[model samples]
Target: MSIQLIHAMNDLTATHKDLLELSKRKTEALTNNKLDEFQALLLEEQKLIRQLEKQEQKRQEAAEAWKDEQHHPAETLTITEILGRLDVEEQKMAEDAAVALTDTIRELKRQEHLNKALLEESMKFVQLSMELVNPSIQSMNYGTASSDKMSGRSLFDSKA
Candidate 1:
C-alpha cells in the first residue's frame, strides 16, 4: 500500500515538472507577444492540466485506501501527512516527491507572475494606442449623458 502511494507521488512529481516547463514556455510566448504560439501553448497547457487533475484523483484514492487500512479518518490529507504513516523507505520516496513537487510549483508560480505582468503591460499599451487614435472620445460611453444637447450617436463613430 505504501509502495503504491510512493508510486503515485513519483508520478505526480514528474507531471508537475512537465507543467513547470510548460509554464516557462507560456511565459516566453506571452512576453514575445506570439499570439499563434501562445494559443497553441494554451491548448497544450489545458491538456496537461486535465492530466494533473486525473493524477490528483488517483492520489486521493490511494490516500483514502491507506487511511482506511490504518483506521485513520477519511478527511483530506496532505502528502506529508500520509508519509508520516508509511515505513522508512516509502517515507523517503514520498519525501523526495514532495520536495520535487514543491520546487516545480515555486518555479511555475514565478513564471506565471512574470507572464501576468507582461500581459498587463500589453493591455495598457493597447489602451494607450486606442486613446491616441480617438482623442475626442472620453471613453466608450453608451449614453446617459448629463445634458440633453449631447448627440445620441454611438461613441465609437470615427466621423462624428
Candidate 2:
C-alpha cells in the first residue's frame, strides 16, 4: 500500500515537472504573439490538467487508505498529514514529491504572471496605435471616420 502511495507521489511529481516546461513554452508563445503556437500549448495544458487530476485522485485514495489503516477518521487530509501516516521510506518519497511539485508550481506561476503582463502591454500598444491612426474616432466608432466608413475595415488593415 505504501509502495502504491509512493508511486502516486512520483506520478504527481512528474506531471508537475511537465507542466513547468509547458508553462515556460506558453510564456514564450504569448510574448511573441504566436497565436497558433499558443493555441497548441493550451490544448496540451488541458491534457496535462486531466492527467494531474487523475494523479490527485490516486493520491487522495492512498491518503484515505493510510488514514484508515491507522484508525484515523475518514476525513479529507492534507498532503502533509498524509505524509505523516507513511512509513519512513514512503515518507521520504512523499516529501520529495511535495517539495518538487511546490517548487515547479511556483516557477510556473511566476512565468505565467510575466506572460500576462506582456499580453496586457501588447493590447495597450495596439489600442494606442488605433487611436493614433484614427484620431477622429473615439472608443472605436467605425462609422465616425470617412476612411473607416468607406472601407468598412480597421485602419490597421492593409487591404483597407
Q: For each candidate, what TM-score against the reference?
A: 0.79, 0.74
| Candidate 1 C-alpha lDDT tens digits along 31-144 | 777989988988998998899899888877887788888888747777767777888887887888778777888887887888788889989999899888886544545455
Give the poorly placed runs of model 1, Cα more than 4 Å off.
138-160
Model 2 RMSD to the real structure? Answer: 10.1
Q: What's the lDDT for residue 90 in model 1?
A: 76
Name model 2 segments beyond 4 Å from true. 136-160
Taking the tens digit of each residue's C-alpha lDDT, what string does model 2 give over 1-160? 6677777878887898898889889888877879899889999999999999999899878867777777877566677777777778778877887787778778878887887888798889999997788775455555546464567655487865
| Overall lDDT per candidate, in order of appearance | 0.80, 0.81
Error of 1 at 102 (Å): 1.6
TM-score of 2: 0.74
Q: Residue 92 in model 2: shift from native, Å?
A: 1.6
